[model samples]
Target chain A: MKSLLTQPIFSFFVTIGLFYFFKIIYTKYPFALLNPVMLSVITLILYLKSFQIPYEEYFEGAKVISFFLGPAVVALAVPLHEQMVEIKKRKSPLLISVGVASIIGVLAAAGIAHALGASSEVVASIAPKSVTAPIAMGIAQKINGIPSLTTAIVIATGILGAVLGPGFLRLCGIKDPLAFGFAMGSASHGIGTARALEEGELQGSVAGLAMALNGVATATVTPFLIKLFF
Target chain B: MIESLFFLFCFLILGEFISTLLTLPIPGSVIGMVLLTVALEFNIVKAETVKPSSKILLNNLSLLFIPPGVGLMVYFNIINEYFLPIVISYFVSTFAVLYISGIIVQRLDRS
Candidate 1:
């Protein structure tokens, strides 16, 4: 039984199964809090802790799943290309706003983390928190931050953004769906874009654009921004 | 499907090769993404060749993060130690970007 728990198939099936299970719950309930990633992570952590299984043992099997993330990131090219085609109409304003927000996302996140007395690594990890998880993981690893920590923070940021993003933008008197989408996508990434989609088609598409552009934009800025202060 | 995987793997490997040669800090995966985008834009790789794999991967993107995310179990102490700062910075940066970007774009559109 001990060896069975350590078996490669054990971790592989557990990770995939738990993820899909919570994914189903999240799909049925569709609450921002029920985010499949968040739910799945929490449940798996508890199970690991309760069973006395080591992270290394579990990771031996799970790493195979992780290997696919690289190619999956390459797959992002499809949506980025699609959105670029759609964004050609009002390109300047869209690009300018996302560009500014992208810079602010890195600067503000890293700067605030530093000022608040987070250690250097924490600051670096938080620097790319505004982008999608895979990109954030990549940036964090490149910059001497903990990639796993960045992933967790990225998820939390996504949940918070999806929940609070649109209403906050509206409170700031944002009436345009495009503006709303851009703000959500730049600040919160994909999950926030999902929230923007809830508002309308225009908001959804633009938010998708914002999410992709913001990924590229934030990736470019994070290395430079962290070097200045760190 | 196999063709799409082939194209994606080619880009991923090419990205790693370039990043190593240049010693750039950007991850090869991101470099791969950018290169793949350029390839698609210039018709170097037809959209249809990658559409199926891209669709499946993008749709299931969140699943890929689980392995890393669960590693959070090891960072509970860091998260606990810096929880206040993390929470504070997250709220400050997230809303600040949202509000400012919204204002800037709306202003840009109006003008």
Candidate 2:
């Protein structure tokens, strides 16, 4: 039974099954708090704990899905390419927006964490929370933060950004899809980009662009920002 | 589908190779994104070849995030210790980033 459960294929199915099940719930309710990723993670954690299954065993199986993240991220270029005309039209403002937002995101996270009495490691981890997980984790490691902790923080930030970003934009009376996508992608990374895609293709494309640009900018600037602020 | 997937993998691998060679801080996949975009722009790779695969991947992108997210379990103790600060910081800062960036872009677009 343990061997069966530990098989990579078995892990894949369980993850897919659990994710789809929660995904349906999310679709029906369509609430930010009912985020499919958060729900699925909690359920899987509970499932593993109840079965006395070690996380390592689960991870060994689930890593297959994680492996696709690299390719999936690469796929973002497709949408970005599709929306290139729109992006190129306003290149300067968009670039400035991404660069400024990237800096602000890092500083805000680190500043808030520090003000709240977080340890230096925690502050460092939080600094890259707006970037995608792999790059954020890489940045965290460079700054001596626990990469796993940064991964968790990045995920939480993504979900929260996905959930609140659209609503916040609506409230702020920002209706342009491009701006909407840019904000969501820069703040939330891939998950937020996923949400932006659901709104429309143009939004998705811009979100993908934002996510990629912010990832690059954050990776380039985070180490320096950490030194300056922390 | 297979062909598109093949192109994606090829570009991604090439991106990774280049990133490693350059020792760039950016992830290889992101570099792959740039490469794929360039390929698409110049017609080096047809859009149709990668459209289907890229759509499928991007649509379900959130699902790929779960494995790493589940790693949060490992930090339960540290999180528990710093629960308030961590939670508060995440909540406040996330909203702040969203609000500030969104407004900034919107304002810039208006001008």
Look at candidate 1 and tell me the lDDT of residue A156: 74
- lDDT of model 1 at position B71: 79
lDDT of 1 by residue, A20-60 (tens): 89878977997667777777778888988999998888899
Candidate 2 per-residue C-alpha lDDT over B1-111 given as tens digits, one digit per residue, 9 for 90 to 100: 999999999989998999899987677898898899999999999899998888888888888888877777777887888787789888877777777767777787778
Give the i-RMS of model 1 in Å. 3.3
In model 1, pairs of residues that clash are none
Q: Please give, for residues B48-97, the per-residue lDDT of candidate 1 as tens digits.
A: 99988877776666677678768778878778989988888889998988
Off by over 4 Å in 1: A119-125, A132-155, A158-185, A188-230, B102-107
Among the candidates, what TM-score does chain A have in each?
Answer: 0.71, 0.91
- The ten-residue window of minimal lDDT in model 2 chain A covers A90-99
Q: What share of the true interface contacts does candidate 1 keep?
A: 0.68
Per-model CA lDDT versus the true structure: 0.80, 0.85
